[model samples]
Target: MREMVFEILTPREIEAKSMETITKELGGRTWPEPEFSIVKRCIHTSADFDYADNLCFSEDAAKIGVEALKNGADIVTDTKMAAAGINKNKLTSLGGEVHCYISDPDVVEEAKSRGCTRSTVCMERGAKLGKPTIFVIGNAPTALIELHRLINEEGLRPALIVGVPVGFVNVVESKELIMTDDMPYIVAKGRKGGSNIGAAIINAMLYTMGR
Candidate 1:
């Protein structure tokens, strides 16, 4: 076998070098700030350049998301993995918290009774929070569908909706539905997203806010 070579680098150095490589590889693609930051983080997380082209942002969505976080808006994610991936220290310093109620007893019970997915019930619970909230959904399309209903029928307006669930079923349809409304949203246009992507997007906005 040929001799293998590897560079030894600290975590920070590795991250920095990875970012530099990503930037260099991006070449002449000039994405604006905020959006660029979000896309870069997504690419870094998955090592997939498609995110650069696949991420869809509503007008001023990134600006609104940053502002909301600065003002202590809570973040509710459909998956615990997404919530866990967010930097809690940075978020708490900004006076916000991340939540995932998918596994809550009430959510499960309600979902069972109503014959809906737990993610759907989680959105209902999140809507009742009655505070400024940013919904980060990265697993369940049903959550996005319910969110759209809450917005159109129940007047539940979130600060920002990060809809990037990854799957074949209803994933594209759910994203399309959320985009139909004029709500502030950052969505992955196709089915190429996940919990990590959602968390990365949130962290990107937080980093941009310097928090």
Candidate 2:
């Protein structure tokens, strides 16, 4: 007969153990610690280890995100789901809040009038906050496109952008557009990201600031 063993661990302990397991499973493959930890956390959230390769950073992506958090930058998301997923407690501690205007009446009316997606109108409205803002777009490529337009054409500057919208249409192109800009960004390349990944990336940065 084999003996049965039961071990209990706290949530933090379990999270640490999970990261250790993810690191060990990667074998010889390595990324810088900050980026690796972000990817590892994404895998931990979605159980999709392929993120280890799919996630891409723009050299100072982590630094920019962490600095934004520390500076109390407001965060905007294209979807309410992503907004809900963000750790508001951590962000509040940093004097920031998660915002999503997708369901606003003004956004809906404007999108209808313009024949564009609500995400596009939402970004247009949210970008006018005029504060240092971090945009974490997950489900809508159109939002990303509008953000790029605002930045390039309308001259709206964001603190940082975490663009990882998942879909077949314009998703790849929108992300590509962001990469061309000289803004700080953290992107999950390919067509394999969603609102959860976007929120996970934000939470990972918040954790970095001990938030």
Candidate 3:
């Protein structure tokens, strides 16, 4: 059996959309600013809103995604487990974008083409609380050092940082930062935590279809 071709959308053109609301929300989540607490009421006397705008994935992943969303995650990240890690029937119930970031485009396309990983990158940007922060090194100590920089530079505010080069080298640090760090913002780690590792991390997050 062959894999499906994973379509790639450059992040370049994504800036032009009316993401003002989304960005604001993302920023608000990471940052505890009072301005984000304001709620807007849309009196749709006739219009109907639905969760159809969300992207779909495998049953287990999808189940996990729902829980993540409930747990306050605007985006869900995951890596395809083997040829058929994700489910399709549940995906059909999804709309919006299914972001599936991969370090190697070739492997992604192959996985999709063969139905090994039928996923998509949910192209929704979480509201930026601040600017893009940089994290270097792979090991735990190095990651801690970089995080200290983020706190010192931005004071644990809303931030958007790339988590690439993840693996035995620095993944421990990255995970530490993600799970325990004080930085409030969205981060994308390159595949796995190694070769194509950055892409794997990215793939996991991309699969999170924003509700």
Which of the numbered candidates is closest to the native, going by highest lDDT? 1
Per-model root-mean-square deviation over C-alphas: 1.5, 2.4, 18.1
> Which candidate model has the greater TM-score, 1 or 3?
1
TM per candidate comes to: 0.96, 0.94, 0.26
What tens-digit string does per-residue lDDT give for candidate 1 at 45-145? 99999998899999999999999999999999999999999999999998998889999898889899999999998998899988899999999999999
Question: In order, what lDDT does every prediction score?
Answer: 0.94, 0.87, 0.30
Scored by TM-score, the top model is 1
Worst 10 residues of 1 by lDDT: 28-37
The ten-residue window of minimal lDDT in model 3 covers 37-46
Q: Number of clashes in every candidate structure?
A: 0, 0, 49
lDDT of 2: 0.87
Q: Candidate order by lDDT, highest to lowest?
A: 1, 2, 3
> Candidate 2's residue-wise lDDT over 91-156, tens digit each?
998899888999989888988998999999888877888889999999999988999899999988
Winner on lDDT (1 vs 2): 1
Tens-place lDDT digits, model 3, residues 1-211: 9989964655533422323444453444331212111111000110111111211111233233333333433221233321122233333344212223333476457656765431221111112222222221122233334444545664543222223333455554544455354443222232233213222222333244431
Relative to the unseen true structure, what is the C-alpha lDDT of residue 36 in candidate 3, on a scale of 0 to 100?
Answer: 17
